[model samples]
Target: MTQRLRFRTSIVLSCFVATNALAHEGHDHPHEAASAPQQMVATAAGPEANSFVADGVTYQWKHRPDLGLQPEAMVAAAKPGLHNNADEDPETGEVVTVVANYGLVKLDQQMKSWSLVDDQDPHFAGGMNSHGMDCFTIDGEVYYASASTNTQEVVVSKRGKVIARLESPKGTEFDNPGVNAYYKSGGRFVPCDVVWVPTAKRLLVVTGYSNGDFAISARRVDGAWKWDGVAFGGRIQQGGPFLTGHGIELKITEDGIETVQIASRGHGRLYGFTPNGAMINLNATEGQYYAQLHNAARPCNLDFQGDLTFVPLLDSLPSTNGVAPVMVLKNFESTGSLIPAEFDDLQFMRHMHGLKTVRRDRKLFAITLSWRNGGENGQGKLNDGQIAIFEAVATQ
Candidate 1:
């Protein structure tokens, strides 16, 4: 007689007990929900071939648990760094869609959910080559965010080509020749400096450099790849209306776009700008505290919504006196700073190289992950790494 394969058919739920009546037995494990899953992969077991960059440093990342390196080559080659990996819909708990490298040759992610992801993913096509730059997806299309603050480019995988170029006002054909109007890198620095603007349908890059003395400038986002608006080397910084490259952090929303800054010097400030270009103070800045930079820099970012802004204050006080970490203003409510010393990956037990938050939002957050453990050709400390999710809450 042949035996039939049997799997559990019923889902165990809670028992119902009537008051003073026959008690109904309730099971603890409920049916798995329909949406995404809430999971956190440890540093080592995560995707291989991952990169997280912070303040000019980069780190390698993998799943917290290496699913058992079958072929050692596959183990070393697999690296999926962090890039807005997690999401928490006020409706959903905590879920993350990780970016990873399947093999040493390409990039993708395994969306960890209720069930183990097999060979398929919701956003999986094939693989996009990242050319050593950070890889991420804007809307299921692969895009790479370079480590550069003033110049970068984004290539849409589906488009099968480099559709956009992100650059500061240095080499572009713009009318500017003074210190105040110089390119951002030529003067200051910015944290998530350049990115693709899907709304305006063009590449958007922000600047705040010190080639001059720390200033802000954005690419001429002309709505269609040609309609450049107010091209100002003059980006606004934290605290007051200073034209610099740092505009806290840039974010897109329903109302408009928002840029923020966090400060260790005086009062913090955030700037609210329209997608088309206009400013209005939203009274979201002003979180004065005493802190110092220890080893590395702190990361600052902002999330803008209509008139509401959520400015982040980060990279507390540094301990060294080398290249003094700076925090600049983006508006009346936003500020920018390198990820401070405490959060520096160099301080981690399994310290990879660079792991800094490049950008963030209520639902998604980005980190530039790298693996140059040491100075150049793989000489640093990290043998393995996983994404470290921090606890945070945003009020805008």
Candidate 2:
């Protein structure tokens, strides 16, 4: 059964609330009781069915009810050896997908179960409190972004072995490549997202909410990683980069023009910029779209296919009719309105937190993370989350 969500003009501020209260305090530091693992329940036939279609998209979904995953981000591998050091399925000889939860988790092709990559790795010195934010693979090397404000380093691993560690750049210049100041001030890096542009040989990192004015950090990695410079808001005084940088994506035009898209969560808007820091007009009316769309809230992780952009609204507030978790904007290059996509009437979809596009067997798939129901850490009592996968099908 599909339920239509009603759109309204009155935007709720509650939708933009931050989850810092539940954020990881520091690496290797003892904390209160951790969230309990979810019980592995038999896949139900009702709303929890394994397959469903929505908005002309057919999806094959799976849930690990036994794992309590906060699912912050993920990196998909279509074939073995592409991401060196990845664990292989003994039965299939294929590389398993890597997901960022408390640490790194490997998901088999079945997607119904998962296992920790290496909890003993010194890189994950935080143990269960280690918050893995984002991940990317390049040149057979996998980079895991550890948001540990205390450690504040990007752990580089190959074939499941810890190899190198990229520490946050140390400097005070606005253009220096480094983690957000919040992390330098004994807080978490809050690294919301990371994107590697092979064409330019650069890595882009965005902070969710940091102390300094600059939120986006870019580094050049030709043969060696070096601070390329930073941009987005340019300098702190201009107040134009990002209010709360949450998600980032790199778009290259047919003419070879590269533009960086950022999800400014605090301002409820999305901004575009050149590789350096100049802003690109998003053609949005009223300066931004999120603030204009009452049905939309805090825009988070974004994935781009051609000109269409898929943005997940990570707001927990109930919608006027119900919660509309995802939004698709057509003709995003031009001025286009937000189109809400229903989550197959799954009531718990309102708790979704992350979004990423993956490929398997040469087909594209969209994956979303649903935090344990209630809220972070199950709203005080620990609980697990759900990983939903949808196969993108052409609209007929």
Candidate 3:
């Protein structure tokens, strides 16, 4: 379901989960909750048919958002209209995705137990110590994750069922030699995005680097999955070549992929790529296809649907010389394909979280966070995450 788009326009670790969420890495500081037995963390809750356990707390499910979310926790990421039931033929090009990695919530929940990569089932495990950042599903085979000592893997399951006992991959595809960027950097990959391309018949994983590098890789789906190699560039300004060069936003296109890379503080650019090959053009704003889409040091979220793009940008109002802060850059660009008239009535949401688009439906959705609380923590006040939907209109 195109995971990356669910994340607001971007991500950068130097700065950067849920119960469903494991603890931060490097720092073994456990959550404020009472310590419990290792295996007890995988608790169970409400309805026997549909339930989830996190950090020793069981959450029951009856009716809520179709995705089953608690009211207070924020909606970290989302993707609308993903029918991941992908079926293609070797002799025929009749493949389509009816399934995808839909909405995901990174809760601060701890795992009842975790196994190091080297110690877990070699054929089945991601190799134990793989920092399991986030979780996703294809056809209902819910599984846990941890990256290999380096950035690698992609474990899938039999469609529609989660086996209580873990099973090694019936087969696996190893990523290219690139993308070994974040081995264990305090659980920053929780918000990372993924793409399963039908044409390429591979899964593209997008992860960040604290050292100013954004790594991406393509894994072949034919027989034994193998990666092409890592391709990286971009980093945070904390002494890196590019300013907030950390690329948090990633999107895959028929020709390649598109992303937003922060170069310097409060500055950014749109990038295009050809799969795991190479960046099609550095900061493609130079190309006639786009104008320089910049941002403030503070990034909100950016989105794309066909050529009609939208970004809930936070920029200074200009009256304070960027010193006191001014306005938000909520932008829309109509690709020559969509009729501008269709979007004339389209409304935009500012101060939002997850933002993603389903190209086939041309529908875009994002989780909205209000500014009422000053964006702070601790208070009866809440960051009630809300979903906003939009239909794109371009200059077709």
Q: Which stretches of candidate 3 lie above 4 Å from their native place? A: 1-191, 197-199, 218-228, 234-266, 282-291, 295-302, 313-350, 358-375, 379-382, 390-396
Q: Give the per-residue lDDT digits (tens) of candidate 2, residues 140-234.
A: 55554333333444554453455555555444423432333433355334454556555555566665444432444545355555444553342
lDDT tens digits, residue span 1-396, model 1: 111111111111111111121111100012111122122111111111123222233433322222111234333332332222122111122221223343112211221222212443322222322221333345455543332331222222222233444333343343233422343234332323333445644333343222221222333244223314333223223122322222233354334433222221111223334333334333322321112212122223333322322222222232222221223222221123322222444232122222222223333232222221222115543323333323122322
Steric clashes per prediction:
107, 7, 59
Q: lDDT rank, highest first?
A: 2, 1, 3
Model 3 — which ten-residue stretch has the worst lDDT?
334-343
Clashes of 1: 107
- Superior candidate under lDDT, 2 versus 3: 2
True lDDT of residue 323, candidate 2: 42
Clashes of 2: 7
Against the reference, the lDDT scores of all candidates come to 0.28, 0.42, 0.27
